[model samples]
Target: MTGEDIYFAGVGDVHGEMYEMLGLLKKWESRLSFVLQVGDFEPHRHEADLQTMDAPGKYRKLGSFAHFYNGSAVFPYPVWFIGGNHEPYGFLDRIANNTEIATNCYYLGRVGTVELAGLKIVGLSGIYKEHLFEKRPPIEEIDRHSNADYIGFTENEVLQGLEFQRADILLLHEWPRGLMTPDNRLDVIDPEMVGNEYARMLVDSLKPRLVLCGHMHRYFCHQIVWPDDTITRVCCLAHTRSGSNAVEIFRLSGNRSIESLRSLDER
Candidate 1:
C-alpha cells in the first residue's frame, strides 16, 4: 500500500487467547495496516485439532480460533503469524505455507516471506532443537512423526531464510543468542540458555531493521549495532495473558524507515 506512513501492531505469544488478543487490538484496528504475531498462536479449528498440538494437556484447550476460521467472528485487521512450539500441526500442516488459513489470518509457514505496506517481512517458524536441526521432513510426511518432529526449525529453513538479502522485519518465535548480557539478564533464566545460535546467525546475516520474537513470555528490547553502525532492534514480547507488555505498535515512513515505535502496555 502506498502511503506517507504505515501503522501496524506486533504481538507476542497468544497461547490460545484469541479473543483477548483481538480485544486489545480493537482500539487500533481502524488505524493499523496489519498485525504481526510471533507464534504460539494456537489456531486450532476444533477439539480434535487441539489434540494434535504438542503442548501440555493443561494448556491444550481450544481457544477462539475456530470462531474466526468458521466465519462466525472476523478479524479486525489482517493478521500474520508463524508456528511456535505449541501449535495445531494437524490443522496447519494440511495447509501450504504462507497461505491464508482464515479470512484475514495467515500462516507464515516454517520459512516464508511477504511484502506488506512497503516492507519486506521474513519469518522463521518454530523453536530450535539440536536433534531436529539438520532435517525437515516434508509437510505431507509430518503425520508420520510425532508433533515434536515439526516443532523445531530445520537447517533447510534457515538456508531458505538466508536467501533473502535483507528484510525490513524479521519474525522469529525464539530470541536470538547473545541478547542477554550482564546488563539485561533475567534472574529466572540461566544466561547461557537465553536464546539460540541459529536465530542469532539469521539476525547477523539478514540484518533486518527490526527483529520481533516471542516464546519466553517476557518483554525485552535490545539493539545490535553492526560494524557499519547500522542498528537492528530486537523486541521480545510477553504472552498475551500478561496484558499490555505483550503488544507493541510501530509506524513506518513512506521511505520505509521506522518513524515511531511504542508498547501498547506503556503508560
Candidate 2:
C-alpha cells in the first residue's frame, strides 16, 4: 500500500479489438499508468489453434494480440487481461499463470493475482456455471463443438479464489450474482444479466476494495455490502464497440480509496 495515487484505465470485452483500445489509450496516455481489459480477450496464439478450438471457418484466424506478440507493434503502457468464454483456451492454458505476452502485456491466469505498479489485482478468468462446478471439460475436450461454449470453473478453480486473503482490486470476467443495485438505464440490474454464484462467493470471502467485470456488455455500478458491513464498489464495463462507453479510468488513493472514476475517452 502506497500513499501516492495509482492511475489506471479499464476496458471490457475487447473481442479482438486491441487497436481500438490502443487508440483510446493514446488519447489518455499522459494520465494513465496502466490499462485492464476485462474479458473476451481472444488471444489466438497460432492460426491453427483457432481450428483446433473448432472455431467457425468465418471467424478470423488471427487474434488482435498477434501483432503485439510478433513485436510488430507495442502497447504504449502495460495491459493486463483475464479470459472470457470466447477466448482460445488451448493457448491460454499454457501460460495461464500471469504470463507476459508483449513488452508490458499480461494474462492474469484463471485464478491468481499480479502486482502492477503499486496495486494488487486478483483475477478470476472464467464465468460461472452450476453444472460445471463439479466437473468441467479438460482443455483438450474443450475443442468439441457440441458442448456449450460457456467457459467456467471447475470446483478446484473456485476453491483457489478462496485462498486469497485480500486484494486492492478484483478483475473478473463476469459480474457476481445479486450484487447490483437497480438502475433503469443499466441492464446489469435485471435478473437476466445477473452473473454467477461462484463469483459472488469469492466476493463475499475476499471483499476486495473494488470489483470490475464486463461479460454483460453494459456499463453499471453497484455498491456491495458484505456480511461484515464492509462495502465494495463493483463496476460492470461495456464491451469494446464503435462509439461505445467501454473505456473507464480510475485512481486509487492510498491502498483502497478510489480517488476518481471517469471515462477515458470523452466520446
Tell me the alpha-carbon RMSD of every candidate: 2.3, 3.4
Which pairs clash (backbone N, Cα, C closer than 3 Å) in model 1?
none
On residues 1-267, what C-alpha lDDT tens digit does candidate 2 reach at each position? 354867788888887778877776566777678888887877665676564332465755476777888888788888889987777777776674878877788888888888877678888887777777787666666556433443776679878878887777888898888764444334433574578888888888888878889988888777877678877888888877743467777876665466435532323
**Per-candidate local distance difference test:** 0.87, 0.75
Over 1-267, each residue of candidate 1 has an lDDT whose tens digit, in order, gives 355778888999998789989877777789888999999999988899876788777888889898998999988889999989999877786778778888999998888999988789999999999889998566567668777877899998999999987888999999999887787788755787788999999999999999999999999998899999999999899999898789888888777677435733332
Residue runs of model 2 more than 4 Å from their true location after superposition: 1-3, 52-61, 141-150, 182-193, 226-229, 242-244, 254-256, 263-267
Best by lDDT: 1
Lowest-sum lDDT 10-residue window in model 2: 258-267
Candidate 1 vs. true structure, TM-score: 0.93
